[model samples]
Target: MNSAKLSHRSPTTDHGSQAFPKELASSVAISQSLEELGWIPRPKLLALRRLGIETVEDLLTHFPRRHEDRTEFPQFPREESDVPICLCGEVTKTSLRRFGGWRKIFEVTLQESNPNALSEPLVCRWFNLHYVQKMIATGQRMVVFGKPRLRGKRICMDHPEFEVIENDEEISIHFRRITPIYPATEGLSQRVLRGMIYRLLNELPSTDAGLERLTPSNLAKGERRDAIRAIHFPASWEARDAAHEHLVLTEFFAMQMLIASRRADASIRQGEKHCGAGALLDRLLKSLPFELTAAQSRVISEIRHDLAASHAMNRLLQGDVGSGKTAVAIAAMLLAVEGGYQAAFMAPTQILAEQHYDVLQRWLDPLGIRVALRTAARQEESGPLPLFEHAGNSERQEPQIIVGTHALLYDKVSFSKLGLVVVDEQHKFGVAQRAQLSAREPAPDVLVMTATPIPRTLTMTIYGDLDVSTID
Candidate 1:
């Protein structure tokens, strides 16, 4: 609420500097100094931070996902069956065709030579990359790395890493070895990004005294950084492999360290307590037509335990369609109401919110519990009476349940005593939006419900920070 301090400011006056502000540098100076005392040179430490890397321990954990072997040119004729191959070749010719509206295809002729016979050319064709045609001329040599297939009399390479080299002289005899390909973004080509990283590495010497080595000994820092440099602009495959190993190790380590830190932070924060018997929950469950499955009961138990814990609950309940995720959620709402706190259910779509409102009101109305529905359509729908227009006072008076789309989160819709926030179909909401909803006054305990059943491994990796309870 402090507008002056929190408001955004134009950076034009302070935008000229290439590095972070001196104030921010001072803020981390003590940590940087401590790292220096621990044998981490200041230059490397700063460089790591510049690359969004922090902590001496963090430097040791970054690792690469995979490696590319560029040592030997695995020509189409020589490629082994079922073996993944990466090689550089020349694009001898290119042609383009417009199939239909805004659809174009490119045909390219890639020349792969036999190591045993340098003069012979094995023609390879690539399709659908019309932009590549503009980059290739008749005699230009290029580096093409990917899987190769024998198509009729000729070999074809699809979606290959194709790049133009300065000359045949640029092709090193040692290029037939392992290389690493880093994750890259559009507009920022891998080659261009690598060049930027190389330039940053070169600038390390001029950085603060305590910062020096970007990668620590626990990782093959030198090799990986070099591999990153070489794979993008490699003279040989061997150099690329060495660089890849180092890079991969560095990336993996960084991620592991970040996870470890978050886990530690969560351990320190205590959860909230909303403990009670299953009386209200049983009533709600018995009210439904179907009996509670063993899986649903187990997830409800986990959620109940979270609600009764010392720290605020941050849980995800995932289930498939018609799997009774909503039943479990309704039970949780009852528990919140029993504990004398208001509950809110937010849905991504207005139609879904209306459906939830109808279900909740039908079940809870008999129990004399106040249930309100707020939606964008509340102002637009034709009806005998507009409940909102006739409510007299805008402020909520009773300890009730409010079900709606994001309309419930409006500034005017303040709760008397907010406790739990149940977000249905969380994937439809942005991460920041969910956080904002959870941060509502009294800082409600969060229960995210999703119908899509994501794989366990992916869920753990992507939503590891949140406590998960799957219905399936």
Candidate 2:
């Protein structure tokens, strides 16, 4: 490995002299509370927890937002450049100028530390930052990164990222080699945060961070444990790039694992066969003003398969606008009704709920399938129908299909036997709201419908446990 411009502050892969004893039992597991380590000060622990970092794993995974190559400094700019560059120089002069009614500008004139005859001074300027003025002084060696612009005969950098080079360099984490720049908060500085991460990388067993190698042989390059360390402070650019690719693949693999687990879980839950022999569904299809498209027919068949499943059906129906998703939804609802259960249709908005109610009532009122409409603003039930009484049914004259907004979740609304719940625009509601509706006796079969365009990766991740049927 090239050791050019490297730092002695960081621990090596072979657990250099900075390595702590494995006897520190608290550091053995990745999930152990950082508080148990006893090395972190109380204030620092509070700060780490505020950033949602409470475990050894959290600290290990706090990868840098970016790394800056400090192996060598760029030559000081003689002209304006749009791209930002990092250069090391010394402060030759400092001054604070007041302008525009109490506004202040802090300017520090820096000359390249090893200036030749051709080098020109670079000016670093900050607006209305009095704190920056207090931290800088003449003759101090500093490293600065920013875009250089020609301001009245001087090459100037505005509001640059900077760190004063320590006169004695061995203790400085900000100087030499590749430096990490992290996403910092109010109380934490980049130097302090970088030091904290570097210490943990060497002091604790990063393999204990709970991420084991899950990829197949030759599928990916390295162990995920080594990737974790390299992601923070890589030894070379190739290693850094490889670590990033491995970590990203690890993330997708983890998501797939969770999705697989959920799919497995849903497979085992016993459910009632909610599908009927297609008497009512056939009537509704025959009554439609138009014919069902091939795609719609295919999607409806998929839903029928789910309804016939032994476990309660959990399905997602996706289609574009102007497609016949509503007609297919109604077909699925009628199947549950024919199986001797009520079907609840909930829309995201009152207007959508009322619209669906109007269409259902118009189509089904003549067919004797009772439809009701309920919203936060309106409650309209079609005239009383004959009671649908069977064994252990508590409801008398219950509407077969009740369409409503979130008002469907109200205590006043009750179902004799809610066998299916169809949520339109499934993305608008919270998880608890969607879940509470299905959390009932024998678990009502859930059929969530959405017309909103979503990326396929996200759709799979969010609804991983549910059966998917797309009209397109």
Candidate 3:
């Protein structure tokens, strides 16, 4: 293993008497933040930060937008599919035509040299594009890509994106392999970012960023490092493909390892067991105009199981728009209330928090449950909450269900016995923000709800720490 400096501040810690030099090891190390890059000015640094590239690690993880396959031209007799078709052909004819002698259209007839041509010729037509008439001549060879449509008897493509092939040597340089197009910000060109990445790679040390440490048993040193290098600048299509596979697998593997570590922590962490579905919960359910859906019942059962467990419940409840996630959350909060504890419902924005407060107040207030609304905007609104009006008695002062935005994390906020926290639109809050709400005497059971369905791959990557239950 390479003895890279793990310290954030002192890149070079002394080894024995001789001080280790700060060379490439300190320059490209993952421990080094973007602030240490030195070349980036304040303005450019802010721009990079806006794009979420804050560290050497972040910059490396910012993958390409799309890889352009500029290799071989498509074979003759193109098959119809959703993907755009690419073809290299010669413009046999160019003509200026008008509809009703007013609307202008430029038509360029393209024909491949191959005898296996599908129809008469591929007609490339542009509407009101007068400059195209002057650019495309009779014998110009160009590459055009678009979906082909049947126009009368001949196969034609309408306004296909094309580029003129200037010389034969250009094929090897631009069309012989895969070329990556990165996601760039304003004032940051692709060429500039590519140049910066290449410079970093060249200056990167062997002990840099502890890349070798992450190289698994299946991947050799060159395999992992070469993949990182090739992903940015590939020599061939085969190299790019192999590099993509290695990086993707590494991402999944890292995510799996993180999930394992979190699971180990969850096994030992203590949590409250609010197992009862008491009178308050039953009254609220029965008072409702409608019945709970089968999906809702199943999810509520899962939450009940988590609440009964000794370990903390870190669960993600996902459902469509009208899947009754709020009802399930209400039931969980009532469980906490029955256990002589308070609960919180956190939303992403003020409007969402207000909405939850309104809906919940109607249901809980009727059942003699105290609910409080707290938001940054609410501080300036009128006066103290109704729960605070009964400040003389601590029992009456504490709210059973506190609904609010991120404002609920303010230092002034306090709960009597915060046992359960339900976060709506859970993606909107960062890990630290969520932690702040759950950090109390005897850590609370966390139930995160999201209306949007995430892809399975993304769920495993982002929410792997949480046990998941889907309503749909």
TM-score of each candidate? 0.63, 0.80, 0.65
Q: Which candidate has the top score in lDDT? A: 2
Q: 45-75 in candidate 3: lDDT tens per residue? A: 7877889888876776677866655555555
Candidate 2: lDDT of 15?
Answer: 19
Of 2 and 3, the candidate ahead on lDDT is 2
Q: In order, what lDDT does every prediction score? A: 0.61, 0.80, 0.73
Best by TM-score: 2
lDDT of 1 by residue, 212-242 (tens): 3446786664544234334443444444455
What's the ranking of the predictions by lDDT, best on top? 2, 3, 1
- The list of candidate 2 runs beyond 4 A from truth reads 1-28, 79-82, 102-104, 128-141, 150-152, 164-172, 206-211, 346-416, 427-441, 452-464
Candidate 1 to native Cα RMSD, angstroms: 13.1
Ranked by TM-score from best down, the candidates are 2, 3, 1
Ranking 2 against 3 by TM-score, winner: 2
The better-scoring model by TM-score among 1 and 3 is: 3
Clashes per prediction? 45, 2, 1
